[model samples]
Target: MIYQKTELGQRAMKDRHAVEITRAQRSALILLDGQRSTASVLDATLSLGVSREDIDRLAELGLIATMPGSASADMPRGDAQLTDFASSTLAARHGPMDLPVAPNNEEERVRRYKKAYPLATQITATLGLRGFKLNLAVESAQGFDGLIELLPKIRAAVGDERVQPLRDALEGR
Candidate 1:
């Protein structure tokens, strides 16, 4: 069956806030450009160890869809609705929106840095190897503002769902 990115998936692709997905899933997602057959995409992703399940998960996440009438007999079209993408890739969890001015006081800055830093690391850490660079970025962040600047990148990497924790910490939650 041929699969293509859904509107939700398209938005995820266009936006910088890419949801955090397994490397396999991300690879599959990139290959599922509508014209490609499921088997072809799968074949291409074999190097990445992507399987039908990973593709299915992308479908489940609503990042990709089987073209209308493209359903093959082997894979039953069940009642299951596609899931939104990971890490809004299908749903990027933007930690709070449009960041405001950073706390001016050193104490408050330090406090926020302490609070948000771990959350940021935790988020990037979920990506495993793909996240190593971003994890380092989180580590190099100097203070609250530096960490805050990284929020958008974080949101792009993991999507908004995972960003909630970082967002909460930034908001002093």
Candidate 2:
């Protein structure tokens, strides 16, 4: 999922509000625009020492939120009947602005997987046990075939009761 700064984040940026934070968190705050995906944010801030932990922390603090992937992400931003909150807010505050252009779908998916690799590795490290070496396989796997090979093992590790849900998530169902 993509992440973006909340109104609180906007306020923080304008110095209208103050939130005690680390240098890394502050750097991350600068990069947390509505347009960038989580992977993009992570990549941009890697050298600044902002990690997923910081993202999670900011999320917990209500300073940021997950932007939907694919199209229609903005629908839930405001009331159910209104998907215009983002643009409306911008227009109200700063006057007219052009609508955002959506990125090409395949390219966005590739970017997502590239970012997901490290997170997958982290999960494997957390859960891979006994002779199950998902971390190594996840690190080495190149594409769909590699992911397919690992699915059963992940299912096995997580167990029958949990496997279907896990599979659905992995497949983006």
Candidate 3:
């Protein structure tokens, strides 16, 4: 899901807190502007050998957290019920976000697919040998639509799976 810098992270960024980190790690911290998904940040940082691990390290350091009201599993559930999107709701609400926005056409779709593909694979990869069939499904999901179809099952298998790029891609955000 989307990540917002924690107060600690913001403080570290602004005051140059003595969190020992490399340049790439700093760049990753800069990218966590609370609007971009984890995968989106990772995709942008791919040329830098990906700051994915850096992002994780930052999160572990209490430097970043999933956006509030976004159904992230890590978010403290103060009283609001988090609805699961891994079942019938997905089928019933494949709304306009599901449609390829008419502007960028196939290129836009492809770019979204590329950004989302790895996130999907990462989620499935965590499933291990038990996910052999699911892994095959991911492998077979050649296009954006195919992957979109499998989103529910992926979520169902991995409760509260953190794959915001996939959701943003689905909703055309």
Task: Score residue 110 of candidate 3 by CA lDDT.
Answer: 76
Residue 47, model 3, lDDT: 32
Task: Give the per-residue lDDT digits (tens) of candidate 3, residues 137-162.
Answer: 88789777788777766654564436
- Using alpha carbons, what is the TM-score of model 1? 0.45
Q: What is the lDDT of residue 42 in candidate 3?
A: 53
TM-score for each model? 0.45, 0.38, 0.40
Q: What is the C-alpha lDDT of each candidate?
A: 0.69, 0.55, 0.64
Residue-level lDDT tens digits of model 2 in 111-132: 5456545555655676635313
Q: Give the range of the ten consecutive residues with the poorest summed lDDT in model 1.
A: 84-93
Deviation of model 2 at 128, angstroms: 38
lDDT of 1 by residue, 1-173 (tens): 88899988887777736665687787788888988887666544443456677888888888988888886632323322323222122222232256645766888778877988888888888877766666887888888888877776677666667888888788777
Ranked candidates, highest lDDT first: 1, 3, 2
**Top candidate (TM-score):** 1
Span of 10 residues, lowest total lDDT, candidate 3: 75-84
